[model samples]
Target: NMIEDSEEDTHERYEVEILSKENRRIPAEMVVESIECRGEPGKLVIIRDLTREKQAEKELKDTQTFFEKIIDAIAEPVMVIENDFRVKLLNNAARELLPGNSETPFLCYKISHGRDTPCEGKEHPCPLVEVRNSGKPEVVEHVHQTNGKERYVEIVASPFFDSDGNFVGIIESMRDITERKHAEEAIKKYAKELEEVNRLKDTFLDIMHHDLLNPLGTAMGYLDLLMDTEDQEIKSELEVVNRNISRAIDLIESATRLSKLQSKNSLELEDINLREIVDRCIENFSYEASKAGMKIENRITQPISVKANKIIEEVFSNLISNAIKYASEGTKVIIEAEEKENSLRIKVKDFGKGIKDSSKQEIFERFRRKEKRSIKGSGLGLAIASRIVELHSGKIWVEDNPEGGAVFVVEIPKK
Candidate 1:
């Protein structure tokens, strides 16, 4: 339709052509020409109103452009591969992703996997085959080598059908996940390093354990020589030295066993006399108790035999040390063992400020302490004791002493 110069100058509305029989005027194109109809000369006129058709064509073109823009806008590589594994379409990203072969319909295997033939299930999965077989979407992850470097990609592929509802091809989208792959590898590396550090720590501990006791044994051997002297003053000093060395030995043994317990290593079990174990613990802790103005009272004189290991003795040693350390001056620390139906209960009670009601269970965890108790300790003593007891199928707990202190108890199976 063309506007006339006269129509533009008028203030009134311009002419609106009618379409078919409708009264409402719309845009139309009409052509009149001379023609011969049935041997008679007549002018034939044809008119076509193109407003709806033009709008529909514009809308369709805009929709097609929008979809094309969307496909090109994605950063991930995308392609449409037919059932024969030939690439039907590829986006700008995919074209740039694959370095060459822009003008050719390349095989998907050649572009992705650099293979001359299509992917077979024996070596690599073929998404086209799988999607056709299942008539559904499929996903796969692959590591490809390009430019002397490896890259991991996650491929999401879906089946595409023609307008006739027949399978035509598969739409495959690829996302680069090489960064995530590196992160997983880093985690595995760190785990291996941590394991190595733990092994070295264990080795260091073993060396320290052995090296420390060797010199202490030598010192004790020499002390025995001095212990045979007749002079009372020299003998008395040697006795003190012997007592301190013995306590040091007990501490080293405790440390060794505690470290081993952290690894959950198996302990050597043997028949042990509970009475002798208690007596030995009291003897080892006598110096510390005396320094705190406390005395240990052993109430278990009868021999009580049980199936336990050498580490079991450390349990009583730790409990006795705690009692003596926490109890007040001039207080008595009592130790007793009672035979039960299927177990033996060892009780160590101290007459001093008792443990808090809430801390009975918390005291057994690593590095936990009551805010009110100011005694200096590594805090692993009770934890180690609890672990050793558990290994022996035993239970260890603390209760409020009837005499204004705490009573620690350990119950172990007699077998």
Candidate 2:
């Protein structure tokens, strides 16, 4: 083939194997030049050894294969992009999910975003640009479009360098975050809806305070004036009306307080003496307990301090009030406290009909009451107490009183 291709004053080259002086095979390149020497047809032949160049070429091909296999073995989509935005190499995952295979000269933006040029703008920032500017790794989110479908992906890009430590391009790994993006959008929508609901609840609470409580107060005052009569029957009927009106007022007040407490995420905490709060609550209910023929026992001794707000007093007030109201006449209501490693536990006990196990948890919810109609309550006392304890990073639960009634337990963190 070389001889046929060779012409006068032209050279043709061919790769051939030759025997060396030691009878060993060696690769050589043969160059033949046809010329007219003194009007006679002649040719000049030269041979150059190509063994070192062939070995170096094989080593380079092997190294490329090794790196390509390593990249292909990775699960996440990875690509090497040039500074000019042209994609240099990509793994199997990138080839499958992205546009333009390894055979094509494609731009990174073109392959991932299906754009005609490099990615720009705030919504789709170029990770290569960021890495080049910072000379560090960067994580950015980009919307990748493939086959008319869009998916969210988070790209971790690092400045890729050559063996000489010179910046060449960027190496990026892509993680699909389509599901996470959808979840975030859903959470944002739900948060907006919850905000609107909270606004409506505040409006309702305002109406309850001004519209409902004011009328009930006026009616109670009128009924009180009418109750000053000699007619015993009229007096009794008016007393019933007064009691019912008072109960309605209590119910509305309790609802408003509980709603306000539930809306707060945190509370102002202070170092409070637990005994003083319990003693004050007991004193407040002393008249009611005496009327019910109940004895209040302050079993708490040794000054105990807890990190809580003043509203914490309301929790003990509710528990003690419930104890006095529900216990049998002449029974004892015991208030005790204990200190643990990280929290303070208080128990308010009553010596009456104990709560059943099934109804214990339900009793802490709003408007949950005992089956007896004789008991008078707004039904929100325990629920209000529960919310206050929760806001103080405390816990409240009901247990059976060993002495025959219910025990309300409250756990408050020390710090």
Candidate 3:
């Protein structure tokens, strides 16, 4: 306003909002200039209708804002890193994990780890490099120390490509797993403690068993001498004593044998007669069975040879004991064997109470027992037997007795 004529007419462009004849505001861009070539005196004015352009720009801005909000709404931290390992796009969750200071670079390593370069070496291996090389997704777990505290995070990374399908960069998703890591470590520690406790228990049993065997042997020896006196009363009393002493010894020995079988991974295999084992076990249990007024039927008369050890005898002993112990007054236990192409099958069936379907497999586990059963046992019989069968590369399972009781089966392969 103070320049008077101002040496000539000035040229300028202006953005202006104009009210159209329809009474609607429209955006416009105008250029004004004085057209003078020494004699011309008119001024030139040009106007551009920028309403459509402005509308388009506003719509694009809204769409970009909507997408950014959606990305930030996700719970897990997500980030997109360029080929040069610079952070390109990150959501709100990612921002919280990275440095917030203005001086920190946008590069992923620098923002998240305060490192000048990408992860390197075993201390901090970057999974993004693996994705770029393999063109496949990769997951890695890392212990991150930030803000004076350590936490574990698992990162899953995948290769990113441009719209044209050209390999460009990587996108990563990360989750904090510090609590889960702590839980796993606690489980491992408890397992170690349990294993040590079992070892100590077995050692104590061994020491006590060795000291008791000597006195038990002396009592049995004195009873055998008294039986030769030919006095009927003394002989009968001696018989009862000998039977009870033998039973105690068998019980002690069973505990030790069970412990030994559990600690071993394999059995010593040899040429063994399974039928002989059954016959001997039947004779061994004859006294108890007769006392309970029960008879055992040994249907396996034919000799079946298998690649097994003396532990095979213990297997049969346990089966027969279970049958006689669980069978009633007049019920008989039947020992049956079938020969197969790959193995031999033996069943010890009792007619009293068959195991519940739910407890059939569980009874073969250590210290597991059926509810409301009065029969006393250490509950380690079938576990030791199953282990032996497994060591011989065979299988053992029990089936419901169609008659009335459980049919205990054992199978071994011929060498």
Candidate 4:
């Protein structure tokens, strides 16, 4: 029980007693009284048991310490800036980057642009000022300086806020990408070298093919002469020989043209009427188309002019020849042209074996044949055609014909 008493002189006193379970009294250490309420004489006491609270506080401190260590261990430079563009905090990585010790606090005057004039004694400072003002990240690749050194860096900046949604600061992270840049450059160099090597190989193949044509012609002529005096059965055999020789000659000619077009040097470009060129190429192949029991249809609009090399003639010739070669007998090969804005688009459509989607992109690569065992080709035709188109600052691609076949489109700039 607790009791409060007031004397007649207006003085108040407070007393508290503790009792055990056995009903025995326990000693009281001290008590407090309210001076303002003498009549009530209220008593006040304090009791404390802080074991659990102390444990919770210790756990929280340990977690914070662990995270701080982790932040300091990061390899990339990390920093925090206030909304006012003031530097607030930075890690060890940032310290190594800045011109000061870790103990020194990062001030706006010390790290911003023009700081070198009064802070670090230099004409230019860092680029962080622009980043902070714009609130946007900045990226820079391999940059060579006047000191004969190169550096590649990517810096990302983002805004920060407090729990109450008040603008607090900004965070900036920086990473070095010099090694990656060097690797990419090395890959480019190797690719260039490989292209050059392929060109040289093509040149060698062209020379061999061209030299074989003369002997092949002579052999076919003698075979023809012999067929004039032989029996019917022997004459039939001579015809087979003549056919094979013609096929060989065609293959060699295609190879020679491919090699000449793939040379490292640029082609001689001249202004020519697109319709005239297409007509001439179609006329040249007219005899072969007629013999194959096929019709050649031209849908050219008119005097469309283009600045391209003479190789364009061969490009069209190969396409038309392939169409004629592969199309079913009596199928028509359509050659059409349209004038596009600033360019000319020519399409060659053949009712033949349509190229599969998976093989479309691969067809542009050298020596990639769909029917390798069955097709009689060096497989350089389409690859050479693609290269020729690219050299003319044009593009060539294949697509499926709506009805049932393949369509090859060639786009060249009119200028």
Q: Evaluate all candidate structures by whole-model CA lDDT and list the values in order.
A: 0.81, 0.88, 0.81, 0.70
Clashes of each: 0, 0, 0, 1
**Pairs that clash in candidate 3:** none
- Regarding TM-score, does 1 or 3 come out ahead? 3
lDDT of 2 by residue, 1-415 (tens): 6766678778788999999999999999999988778989889899999999999999999999999999999999998899888888899989877855456578888778667877777888899998998999998999877667778999999998889998889999999899999999999999999999989989998998889999899898888899999999999999888778888899889989889888799999989999999889999999989888889999998789988999999999988888777775527888899889999999998888988999999989988986646555789998999999999888999988776888889999999
Total backbone clashes of candidate 1, pairs 3 or more residues apart or in separate chains: 0
- Where does candidate 3 stray beyond 4 Å? 1-11, 18-25, 33-43, 102-105, 130-135, 145-149, 163-168, 198-248, 263-293, 298-316, 325-328, 335-379, 386-415
Please provide, for model 4 over 69-133, each residue's C-alpha lDDT reduced to its tens digit, 9 standing for 90 to 100: 88789898777777554667777776655544345355544553224332221233233455445
Provide the lowest-lDDT 10-residue window in model 2: 369-378
Model 1 TM-score on a 0 to 1 scale? 0.53
Best by TM-score: 2
Q: Between prediction 1 and prediction 2, which has the larger lDDT?
A: 2
Better of 1 and 4 by TM-score: 1
Residues 150-195, model 1: lDDT tens digits:
8787789999998999999999998888999899999999999999
| Model 1 ranges off by over 4 Å | 1-59, 66-80, 86-124, 130-137, 144-150, 160-167, 202-226, 232-248, 265-320, 326-415
Q: In model 2, which regions exceed 4 Å deviation?
A: 1-13, 16-59, 99-102, 230-232
Model 4 ranges off by over 4 Å: 1-91, 94-253, 367-378
Give Cα distance to truth, residue 223, candidate 3, Å. Answer: 6.8
lDDT of 3: 0.81
TM-score for each model: 0.53, 0.86, 0.68, 0.51
TM-score of 3: 0.68
